[model samples]
Structures are given as C-alpha cells and as structure tokens.
Target: MAYTAPLLNKPAEGWKHDLPGPNQPPTRTPNTRLLPNPPNYVDDIYLELPRSTLAIRSVGIWAAVIFFLTSTVAPVLLIDFTVTEGHLPPFVLNFFGLVLLSTFLWIGVYLWRMDTEAPRDEPIRFNRLRRKVYVYRFFHDGAKPFSRTAWGVRPVAYDWDDLHAEACSLYGPMGTGGFIETVTLAVLKPGTHEVIDRFLFTHEIHRGEMYWAMAQLFMQQGPHALPTFPYVPRDWNNEDVSFNLARRLAPKVVWPAEMDLESRTAP
Candidate 1:
C-alpha cells in the first residue's frame, strides 16, 4: 500500500511543500536547479540548511586566499626574524615555514570539506514505504528535480532507528536595520542526551510550520520516525532576545499540543 502524505491528500510537485495551501502544484516549475527527475517513490520532502552552488564554491576560493596570504607572509616573517637576525639556523626558518604551511593547509582542507553539497549529503531523508531510514549522503536522486543541484554522490541507507530532534535559531539586525536569521535541527541520540546529527535550515522565516511538519513526519506511522521538537531551544547569545520575537512568529501548522507548552508561552 502506498502511504499518502499524512494530513494532506495531495502529491507535492517536485519538493515544493507549501504547507496548508490548496492541493495543487505551483503554476510552473521552479527556476532553481533540481535533480533532473525525482522518482515516484519519495514523499514528504523536507529540506534543511539548503545552500546555493555559488555559496558552496566560495569555500574553495576563501580557502585558497587564506592559504595564499599565509604562505606568502609566514615564510617571510619567519625568515626575517630568525635567519635575518642570525638567531636560528637557516634550516630552522625553512622548517618553521613548512610547519606553518602544513598546519594552515590542514585547516583549510577541513573547512572546505564541511560543505555537504560537495559530498552530496541530505542530512536526513525518509522512505515511508520501505520502512528504512535514508541517510544524508546515501540515497539515489530518484530522478526528481532537486531543491539544489547535487554534487552527484548518491544517498545511502542510515543505520539508525530515529533522530531525536531539537532546533536552535536566531534573528538579529543585519546592521542595516534588517534582520538576518538561521535555524538548525539537531538529531540527537535516542537516550543519554547526545547530539548525533544536525540538519541546518538557513534563512527560513517560518520556524513553527517547519517544526510541526517535521514532528508530524517523525510521529507518522512506520518503523521509523524523526524525533519531535520538545521546546524552542533558547538562544542566550541574544542579549535582546525578546526583540521582534512576537512580530516575527510563524503560524502553527501541526499538533501544537505535543510541543513544549512551557516554552510556547514565553516571550
């Protein structure tokens, strides 16, 4: 039996999930590049921390710039202070430069590697019919149009039962009187309070709907379910956390009763 999208009787066109809207596709295809074709089998598509190709490519550029500046300046500085001053042997300066270059080279590689798009990871995906958990980096494209163009690595199965989830978000003036926002859902270990995974959602304004939809998806019947968001994780970093909080709220989309009522009542 094909499991329909719960609480909604319609199939979503591509991965454009317009919650609470009428059951119909958008007038036209999205201009953003998607997978050439999504398969008939995927449903309830939720995207976390979607980034652009330009953003992904920028990592390498920044990495190169940092490495270039460091390589150019560090060697000269080491040579000037040590070899020029005759305080250390010539080999000492050479070895110091080599060590400095090697350290920054490793750091640059690690930062660039943090991009999931480079590795084609999904962060999280579900196959309701298969009753198996699909990992961020492990599934096939299913021929569907993707939210973003992939790096071409297929997604595979994740060996986990469920992801216990929590989200932490923040919004503040971008120094131009406009606000900037970011949110991330943490998938924690089922017990013992350990964060095992994280799926990021950048610049999304509707947090409540996103959280409700995810909780519903996880609570939906099947052998697997993602964890539910219990409370609105606090952002202590914001000294004026109350600023614009009420005016910038997202509409409730799902079972609000199941959420952390205590936090829901706060400013």
Candidate 2:
C-alpha cells in the first residue's frame, strides 16, 4: 500500500522575506495559536535495521566451515612427504599461501556480514535549530569487539533554494500482484555536512510523489537546475492514482516569507 500523507497542524510562519522578483509582494499570515492541550509530537517513520538472527547464524556457520576445510585439506594436499634434504616443494608452498589467502578472505566476508547486520534504532529526532536529524543507532558505546564496529551515520538536512524535480521509475511490485512502473518527478535538495570532519555537499533525493507534493514550495519556486534520481516503480498506475488523488484533496499549506527564508538558510 502507498504511504499516507501526514497532517501538518502547526501554523505557517514567515519563511522568506527578500522576494526574487521586484513586483512580487511579501506574503504574511497570522501564526496559528498553540493548542491548549496539544498532543506530543513523535516521529514514527524511519529506516529500520535488519534483525534476522537466522541470517547471522547462517553467515557464521559458512565462515566456520570454510575455515575448517581450508585449514585441514590445504595443508594435507600441499605438503610433500619425501622432501629432498630440507627443501620444501614449490607447489606445496604455493598451496599453503593460497590457503592462507582464502582464510583471510573468509574472515573479511564474515566481518562485512556482521557489519551489515548491525542494529538500527528508530524515531530519530530532528532539531530545527541545527537543521539536522540525530541518528541514534549508528554509534557504539563501549570498547568490546562488537561495540568497536562502526556504522555509517549522517545528518539529514536540505537547502530549500536548491530543490528541483525530474521524472523517474520506481522499482517494486504493487499490491495488485503485478509489476509497477512509474515516471515520477523526484524532489531533490542540496545538503551539507562533515564526513570524517571534511566539508561536503550532497544531493538529498525524496522518494515517492507524496514527498514532492509536501515540498511544493521548492518544486514551485526553488532552483531549477537540480537533478533527479533514478527509480523503478512497482505499480505505476496505482501510484499515480493514489498520489494525484491525494494531491487534489490535500489541504493547501502556506508559509510566511521570513520563516521560508529561515528554512532555506538553515544549516
């Protein structure tokens, strides 16, 4: 099933001030008063870490089997019994070296598999002031073997001005028991952060048509030169039907010019 759009109840705030066009007048609106008994805000959608114990065990078993076979069989087949004086056979030496290399390869594969299975915690918090979302699961807290393993973690932030859209396909099977295909215009924005403490700018692409609609401000008035990411749709017609219908029925979201500017300039 396609994802549902979230209702934004917060009052629109001033987002941008300096209009790009001279004739365009500044748009302003009254801020929505806070609810007397507002419900607590919580983030429920997030990428989940794979947690398959069977997968982990399977990898472990494979690694052990490979190590045992190589250690026992390679030595027996490669070692020469009747050595001339004290010299070892060249073929035997090469065979042992190959076995050692195979062992190292198996070990590397085991490590990689473990890393891929690392746990991911959910409901990551987003800080508007810092313009970044905090990822809680990618870091370890202790010095143990598993704790020493590092997972890839990065902040999610975007530049409102550098956003754009382009058509692409989304790969996956639809709910109707058929392959889905689509030509959606992905919404993208530029992001900045430190990878290993080095400054870098990366393009952040928002998948699904709903995100594009939610971020309409950028789609309508932001930068026009951004690129779209490729996708493969599972069900093109269904996606289009759902997305377009939602867009038509969704409530209009308005933002104040100054607040728009702040969101655009947020780091």
Candidate 3:
C-alpha cells in the first residue's frame, strides 16, 4: 500500500551525555603495573663481568717479551758454549729448553687471555673517536698466590648502522669448563673491525642472541622487517606482537621509541 520510513530510537541517558568540558583532562587510572622502557642502541648496554681474572694485554706483552728475548739472545749466548766445549753445554741446552717453553707459554697466554677477558657485568664503553670497544677484566695470578690481574680489550668498532643482527649463546654444559659466554653483533663485513676479532673470540651462542635482539630494538631504523621468532610471520600490522617479543627478549634494555615523545622531539 504505502511506503513508510522507520523511526530511530534515541541513545540511552549516559551514552549521549556531554563529555566533561574540553578544559577538563580525561581521568587517569593509576597504572599499578610497571612497564619496561624500549631498547636504545645509542644508550649504553651494561654487560656483567665474568668470573675469570686474567689481564690479556699485560699477559700478551709479557709473552711477547719472553718470546723475543729467548729467540734472539739464546743463540748468541750459546755461541760461547759451542766454541769452548765443541758442543752446547748442559746449561746451554737448558736455555734452549727455556726458549721452546717460552714460545708455547706465549701461545697459551694468548688463548688464556681471550678466555678470561670476555666482558661480563660491566659497561662496555664504545669510543667513537678511536672506533673501538674497551672493557675491563680481572684475571688470577697463579705464581703470586693472592694476586689478581686486570686487563682491557681493543675491539674494532663497526658503525651501529652496519650491525645486521646479534645473538647470545652458552658454549658448554653448566658447571663444566667452558669459554666465557659471548654476544656477537653480526656485521656486514669481516675486516670492518679487525682488532676485536683478532683478540677476542666474539662468536658465542647466547651473547649473539642478546646482541641481535638489542641491536634490532636500538639500532635499526624505521619499522622492523623480520619477526623476532620463526613461527611469527613478518607483518608491520602486527606491531603488538613485535613489540612484545622484543620486550620479552631484553627486559632491561630500552629502545628509542619508548622514550618520552617530548624528549625525542627536543631540539
């Protein structure tokens, strides 16, 4: 018969009520939960000190000195013994033994230096001027019963931008003799930082993971391209998932994004 328009019902009382005046700030519910700050690469990340107590540089210098003196002077000194006795004396043989012993000692010192000097529970200070990372370590002196040694490493620095990712790992079973745990920040090139690779064995399992996670959160520009975990697909739309994963990975680390907007915008 006749076409008719349906009538619209009015909204309920509280639903349509006027919001408090524009001048009034919105109510703030107390945030009882403490949230962690995001990771920031520009900011320093503190690594804990390891248990070992060896000075890599000091031991290295001593090793070199021992090697040089024995190799260069031992032969010259032995010439006297050869001329007088028509053969090297017992003392001369002992000296030669010392030279061989010193050579191997140097090698042992070099390896021990790396094992003991890995960074732990300390702030790894990055020097932009020298393009190096310096860390202090403590080493024990067996010869001197109650003495400990301190040393530093001169790792070549790659630009924070060059870091692709990082990883952390433990090499051996718990409670067993193992190298210091390490975190390697993966760079695009090999020779970018020769000093670091030459001295310290940067490649380790858990430490690399930690470095990769922190670097991604701190150093990476723009949006993250890859998912933190394998099962998760890479999707920009899933920021919550990405953010949550990063947070879980490094609770103490802070990201630039997490800084107050005011601080980020400041001149």
Candidate 4:
C-alpha cells in the first residue's frame, strides 16, 4: 500500500490477511512465525524494549553544520550587508545580523534537543502480569516540537485492551528519495476510535510484524508464549562503548513514583 503521509488516528489495519495457525495464540494484532524484536530487559513480570535505533553520526553532522553556519556564514553575510548598505543605521544592520545568526543557532539547537536531549533509549515496557503497558515517552506538542511547553519524560500506563497496532509508511523528503516506515501502537479513548496517544513499535517495516507479535504474545499469553533462543534477555547497561557513552550523556529514565508503583504492580 502506498502512503504519502504518516498514518494516525485510524483503526489498526493491514497486517498479513492469513489466519493464525495452531501454534499461535489468539490475539487482536496479527502474529508472526518469525522471532520478535528482542527485549533489552525481560523478566516473568515485564518485557522492555528500546524505542528506536540511535545514529550517533547524525548528531556529528548536525553539529558540524551548526558550527559552519554560525562561524563562517554569519560573518560573511554581516560583512557583505554592511558594505553594500553603508547608509543604513548601524543598529539596524546589527539587528539583522543578530536575527540571522540566531535563526541558524535555533535550528541547530532545536534538532539537538528533539533527538539527543532525549533519554538514550525511550523504552516501552509490557507488564503482562498487570495487563498494562508502560511507555517511557518524551511528550511534546505535535505541532510545536520546538516549543518549550508540553515537553518532558511524561511516562504513561495504558490497559492492554485499549492499545492497537498499525503499520505506517511515508515517502522521505524529495531529494533523499528515501522511504520511512514504522509500526505504531495507538491508544484509544475508551469506547471510541479517537486516538488518545501513540508511539512507535519499531522503525523497520519488514520486521514490524515481529515487533507487534512480540508485544501481543506477551500480553495475551504471558512470557512463556515468546521464543527463548534468539529472544534471549539483554542488559542495556552492558551494551557497546557508543551506547554507554550516549547513555551517560542522555537523561536517566526516571518514572514518576506513583506511576512506577502502579505500572509494575498488579491490580
């Protein structure tokens, strides 16, 4: 299916149309025979997985662009402007220069905050025993990502039944000719189809089923329902040097005390 925009606020649909076989558990979301996205941490009670793949190189690229614009481009523009319009008031020229420099700086900072300032890995936790899902999210206004308001680690708990998964895809920016895909779990507003909230299940389109099935199997049938071999437990703390460094630089995953208790504990 060809999609031009990010899919949102619709009923979860478009999984493989086949019926489940004998081994698969009865689930609202589709199941896959293939292995699920492995958890960063798992136990009898809960399963935890990372939000997205981190690209450290992207950070460096942005940093370089910011440096070049502020140091080189700003000076060149200011010098040219002053020479060309010598009759203009010094303060007016200075103001223009400041605004131009500030715009570039803000763009750099905004991108940095949007990506790097977040927790090293915003993981989603499936508490099977509690029949609830805990999302460690960095909430910001959908329309205003650059705004300071409506932002932070506002983690939430949702009943397993209220959640639905959908596979969404969109074309990348014009020059890039790239494609972007994500499996998203949208939280419904009780009896209505209206979407209350949503988050990414996995960024990979091909493996979206596995990720969805992983959560579905765990929630519907418990930890025993999942595979044991390639889906072995992993320690997020003991990851590679790059991960360790990023973890150190990023904010710690600190859930609110009341929510922490409620999410992990059974009713």
Best by lDDT: 4
Candidate 4: clashing pairs of residues:
none
Model 1 per-residue lDDT tens digits across residues 147-225: 2343243334432333322223344434556443333333434543355554443234244234334434432532234
Report the poorest 10 consecutive residues by lDDT, candidate 1: 246-255
Model 3 bad stretches (over 4 Å): 1-96, 104-157, 165-183, 186-203, 220-267
Q: Point out the worst 10-residue segment of candidate 3 by lDDT.
A: 13-22
**TM-scores of the candidates in the order shown:** 0.39, 0.29, 0.29, 0.72
TM-score of 3: 0.29
The reply for model 2, stretches above 4 Å from the true place, is: 1-68, 80-87, 95-109, 112-117, 120-124, 127-130, 137-267
lDDT per residue for candidate 3 within 152-212, as digits (tens), equals 4322334433332222234454366664444333333433422222112133433333333
TM-score of model 1 (CA atoms):
0.39
Please provide, for model 2 over 1-267, each residue's C-alpha lDDT reduced to its tens digit, 9 standing for 90 to 100. 121321112211211111111112212211113111111121122111111112122344355456656556555545544244355557757766677866655554454444333322111222233333222223322223233345333323333332222222234344565322221211122342111121111111122222333223223333221123233212211233342332233222222454333333434
Error of 3 at 56 (Å): 13
Candidate 4, 148-196: lDDT as tens digits:
7666777778887777666656676646697666676778777665788
